[model samples]
Every structure is written in C-alpha cells, then in structure tokens.
Target: MTVPLFPLNSIVLPGGRIPLQLFEPRYLDMLTRCMKDGIGFVVVLLRDGAETGAVARFHPVGTYVRITDFQQLGNGLLGITVEGESKVAITRSWRQPDGLNMGEVEVLSEEAYAPVPETYAELTSVLVALCRHPVIQDLDMTVDYADARQVGWRLTELLPLDKQEKQRLVELRDPVERLSRLQELLEALESG
Candidate 1:
C-alpha cells in the first residue's frame, strides 16, 4: 500500500487521537488528496538522521490515521483531528515535487491468535488508579482493556516516554511482554 506521509516528532498510537496543524503547502495538498479519496495517511515519527533541507528520517513503523475533523484556520493553516486506525511499515519513501514525502507501506495485521493475557487486568487496574490520581487526573485519559492491543498503544502514546521506548513497546508482539512493560513503567512512576 502506498500512503502519503505526515512526518512529525509526535507518537500516534492506534486508537489515539492526534490534532495537527497543516500549514506547509505540501502537507496541505496531501490532506486535500486524502479527503478527496476518502483514504487515510501515515503518521511517522521524525528522527534526527536527515540533513538540513533534506527530508527528515522517520521510523519505519507508523499508524494509519483517518481525519475525523478538519477546519481551515486563518492564514492558510488547517486544523485537523486524526484517529489512528492501524500500524504499518514503510517499505520505501520518495519525495514529491511539492516537497511532500510519500511511502510504499504494508499494513501490519493484528496478531492473529493472540489472546489478552491475564496480567492485563491487573495492569489496567493499576493504570486506572494512576489516571485517577489528583495530580494526573487532569491529563484526561481513558483506560479500557477490552482490547489489549489498543490499550497498549494508548499507554505507549500517552506516556511522556521517549521514541526508543515507544518503539520498544510497539515491537513487543506478545501480550504478556507488553503487559510486563506497562507494569514496570507504572511501578517505576509510582516509586519515583
């Protein structure tokens, strides 16, 4: 699958909401095309591996984001809310004449036979408590473990975690491993 790329420093997890300001001409064109075709674009994390005036490097793993709401802001800026749909891997990237980055991508299917591990229940309880704490409750987060994969992605995105840490969480295929990582993070936060 080929996808128009939106490269940013922010992490967009599956089932998460991302609001973007599209002011660059190239991205404005990209958004126009996406809206016309009723298709989504890929949101990839920008890394510091590209030179000046060059296309920024992006993590291979990204999520398909559907535009939920869009409005034209003043001065040719666009405000849009995107909901992440699924994870994808970039196979190749190329530049368009308008300075937009496009990529050939493959959507990563959800783990076929994996079941939500028992540990997730405990982890979700802990996370809910953390969210309800007076200090952090204003963060306005919602925790739902009905779908473990979605929960994992939400946690990975919402936490003030670094890119490498988020990548590690994304790469973990086993539910148990993912739950363990969440538990460890929560514990560390509690003890710190």
Candidate 2:
C-alpha cells in the first residue's frame, strides 16, 4: 500500500503515541487527505536532512500510525496526536512536487503475543513508575504489563535512549528479542 511519509528524528513503535505540530503546507495537506480518506500514514526516522525544507532520507522501516486526537493549539499550528498501529517497510519512496514524501509500503504482521518473562519482570515496575509522571499520564497510555511488546515499546518511548537504538528496537519483529535488547540497553545505561 502507498502512504504519506512523515520523517522525524525519533522512532515511534507500535502502540506509541506522538503529537505533531503541523505548519508546513505539504504536511497540512497530507493531514487533511489522511483524515478525509480515513487512512493513516507512515512515520519513519530520518537518516539525513531536517524535518522541514529538503526531502529527508528515512529508514526503510516505519510505524503505520492513525490520528487519534487533534486540537487547535494556541500558536495556530494544527496539533494532532497519532498512535502507531503497525510496523511497515517502505519498499520505495518519492518526493511530491509539494515536498511531501510518499512511500510504497508493506505492513508487517503483528508480533505474536508473548508474555513478559520472569527475568524481565522488573522492567514492568520501572514502566509503572515512569507512567506516573505528568507527561506520560497526559498521553493516556494503556499498558499491559503481561505483554512483552508493550513493556518494550513503552520503555523505549519513555527512556532517554539514542534514536538509533530506538530504531533498532522498532525494527525487531520479535517481542522477546526486543525485550532482551532493551534489557541490554538498560544495563548499559546503569553501568555507564
């Protein structure tokens, strides 16, 4: 399926929510079309270039996201909150005349449900503590502690991890593997 691409410096995994301030004509147009068509777009991390102006080079893997809520911010730019619905791989991409990037994508299958292992049980508690913060609470996230995917995605979202590291987590198709990778990162963070 072909979809509009919104390249950012960050990675948004499945079940993550991100708010974007849209001021560019290309993206504003894209938003209108997406909402009208009731179709979501792909959010990918940029490998090069900035979010505005020149067309950015983005990673092939991205999260297919749907707009969940929207509001008119005081600054006048359109504010929209989107939730990642599924992972997608961009097989091809091109820049439109308006500077919007479009991609021919394949939606990846959802990871099989795997329970959070006993060894990683402590990660769930860390996530619970992080969620109490006002910023996370504002997102109104629904987390399932028993699910390995949720634990990995939520931690990756809230942690101050590098973008490349987060991208690696997002690209992993296995929930257990993602959790194990996350544990390694957490350990590194603590030891360093």
Candidate 3:
C-alpha cells in the first residue's frame, strides 16, 4: 500500500519510539490525514540531504509508525511521539503535489525470536541501564523486554551508533542475528 514517508537522519526499529516535530505544511497535512484515517506513516533513514524542501535520499528499509501522543511545543510546532509498528520496504516513492514524499511500501513480517538466552545476560542487563540514561529517558522507553528480539530493538535504539549503523540494524530481518550483532557491538564498545 502507499504510505506517506518521512525521511530523517535517524533509524527507528520496531517497538521503538521517536519524537518528531511537525511544522512543515506538507507534514502537518500528512499528520492530520494519518490521525483521521487511524493509519501510520513510514520513516526511512535519510541517506543524504535535509528533512524539508528538497527531495532527500532515503533507505528503502523503514519502520511503519503511528503517533502515540502529541503536544504543542513552546514555539508552536506540533510535537509528537511515534511508536514503531513494523518494518516496511519502499517499492517506489514519489512526491505529492504538496511536496510530501509518498511511497508504495510492503509491510515486512517480523521473524520470531526465542526468548533471551543466557549468553546475552550482561547485554540484557545493560539495556535496563540504557533505558534509564538521560538521553533515553525522554523517549518513554519500555524497560522490560520479553525476548531477544525485543531486547535487540531496544538496544538498537539505545546504542550511540551512526545512522548507517542504525540502518543496518533496522534492515536485519533475522532477530537472532540482530541480537548477535548487538552483542558484538556491545563487546566492541566495552573494549574500545
């Protein structure tokens, strides 16, 4: 199905949340339509350029997300928290007459992961710590994860990775592999 696209410099994994500001006319309209239709939009990583005006480069892999809560910022911009639903692949994309990026997207199925294994106990424990960090405190992060995949996505959100690294993590369809990569990255982080 076709969905409105928001290409930003950040990647949000399934079950993660991202705070967004809607001030541009195109996006403000998009947000209204989404809220009215009870649907969500796609958020892809901006491969190049900015979020507004000019058409920017985008990663095909993205997360479908819905606005969970909203408030008016002091400057009067629409501030909203978006919760990721699932992964989507952009089959094709084009700009609307109003400059909104619209895409024909495919909803990707999530692969089931086994429960968190003992090997990643340290990694899982650290996720709790990561959730309480000041930077993560604002996202309204969930501190509990039932499975390794949940842990992977949450850790993916918490880690201080570049956009490219985050895109890689978001694109990985295999939950176990995602967790394994997270573990490796955590190990490297500790060693560095």
Instruction: Name the top lDDT candidate.
Output: 2
Cα lDDT tens digits, model 3, 1-192, are 899999998877777898988899999999999999999999899999899889798999999998999999999899999999989999999988899999999989886866887878877888888887786788876655658888888888778877788889888877778888888888888899
RMSD of each: 3.8, 1.0, 1.6
TM-score-sorted candidate list, best first:
2, 3, 1
Quote each prediction's TM-score.
Answer: 0.81, 0.97, 0.92
Span of ten consecutive residues with least summed lDDT in model 3: 140-149
Q: Against the unseen true structure, what C-alpha lDDT does each candidate score?
A: 0.75, 0.91, 0.87
List the candidate 2 regions with Cα displacement exceeding 4 Å: none
Best by TM-score: 2
TM-score of model 1 relative to the true fold?
A: 0.81
Is candidate 1 or 2 superior in lDDT?
2
What is the lDDT, from 0 to 100, of the residue 129 in candidate 1?
58
lDDT of model 3 at position 16: 88
Residue 164 accuracy (lDDT) in model 2? 83
Candidate 2 backbone collisions, by pair: none
Q: Could you tell which candidate, 2 or 3, scores higher by TM-score? A: 2
